[model samples]
Target: MRVLGVDPGLTRCGVGVVEGVAGRPLTMIGVGVVRTPADAELGHRLVAIERGIEEWLDEHRPEYVAVERVFSQHNVRTVMGTAQASAVAMLCAARRGIPVALHTPSEVKAAVTGSGRADKAQVGAMVTRLLRLAEPPRPADAADALALAICHIWRAPAQNRLQQAVAQHASALKGRTR
Candidate 1:
């Protein structure tokens, strides 16, 4: 499966694409940041992010999108902007009929670093090691995005299996009722 992971921000949104089979290592297909001028209006920044994400979807045609969920404190403005950016990403993916999974920052950190509270540098280091890259992914945002993708890929199978088991149990229950 190919997954696009997004770390949303008003000024610079980070994106990464990774491909992997169910039981194989993930391969990095691409990674980059979408930059909007710091001085640009919030509306413009959002538009830029939307357009950039659309372009990415068009180019990569990823099967799924994984975005970092917003969790902020004492900064309503920042939280709102992050939420808006994440919405744009979800919208873009939905437009293409691609399923989107939202992962918390803590989840991504834990997946990559084995610690929910791991620092950025530690996450970056682990991301590099996981991907077997000679160097860390550039721009902290990009690394975060990649981590989000990794987390989703690692978690998806378990989620799918659980859902399947639930469905099977429901079907058996219905049969007995009949």
Candidate 2:
């Protein structure tokens, strides 16, 4: 499956496209950051992000979008910006009828590094190694976006099976009720 992973931020929103399935090496199709001037008005920044994300969606046409979930931080303002940027990513994917998956920072780290407490450097290093890249993606955020995509690709199979089991159980229960 091909997935577009988004690491949302006000100034630098990281975006990457990865393709492959579980138990196989993944391929990095594209990786980049969308920059919006900090001085730009809030609305303008969001617009810039929207345009950037839309262009990504158009180019890659991913089957799923994996976005980093906005988690609480000490700075309310920082968190607010992140939350907004995240919403923009989700909106763009939903508009295209693409399925969206939200992964927490810890979850992503754990999936990539075998430790939820892994630091950025550790996560970056693992991402580099997993993708078999000669170098890690720059600016940390870019590496993070790729990590999110990798995490989703690795976990999707289990998630799908759980959903299928739940659905089948529900259907069986309904038939019994009748």
Candidate 3:
């Protein structure tokens, strides 16, 4: 599967494309960051992000989009910006009719580094090793975006199965009620 992972931030939104299936070698199709000036007006900043995401969606045409789920932070301003950026990513994918998945930071960290508490350096190192790249992707956010894609590629199979089972159970329950 081809996935575009988005690490959303107002200052630097990371974008990466990864292609692979579970239990197979993964390939990094592309990786980069979308930057918007902090001094820009809020509307302008959001528009920049929207354009950046749209360009990625068009260029990569990914089957799925994995976005980092926004989490609460002590810095309310930072969290708000991240959540806004994340919403733009989801909106872009939705407009293209591509499926979107939200992965938490800890979930991505554990998937790539075998520890939820893994540091950014550890995650970057793992991403380099996993993709067989000569060096880690720069700016940290880019690596994080790739990690989100890798986590989804590796975990989606099991997650799908579980969803299917739950749906079947619900169907059976509805039949009994009828």
Steric clash pairs (candidate 2): none
**Per-residue lDDT of model 1, residues 41-122, tens digit only:** 9899889999999888889999999999887773677888888899999998998889999998889998889999999999
- Candidate 3 lDDT over 39-147, as tens digits, reads 9998999999999999999899999999998978646869999999999999989988999999999999999999999999999999999999999998899999999
Worst 10 residues of 2 by lDDT: 68-77
lDDT string, candidate 2, 17-89, tens digits: 9999999999999999999999999999999999999999999999999999887864676999999999999
Error of 3 at 62 (Å): 0.4
Candidate 3 lDDT: 0.95
- What's the CA RMSD for each of the models? 1.6, 1.0, 1.1
Candidate 1: give the clashing pairs: none
* TM-scores, all models, native as reference: 0.93, 0.97, 0.96
Candidate 1: residue 80 Cα off by (Å): 0.7
Instruction: Report how far residue 41 has shifted in candidate 3, in Å.
Output: 0.7
Ranking by lDDT: 3, 2, 1
lDDT, candidate 3, at 155? 91
Per-model CA lDDT versus the true structure: 0.90, 0.95, 0.95
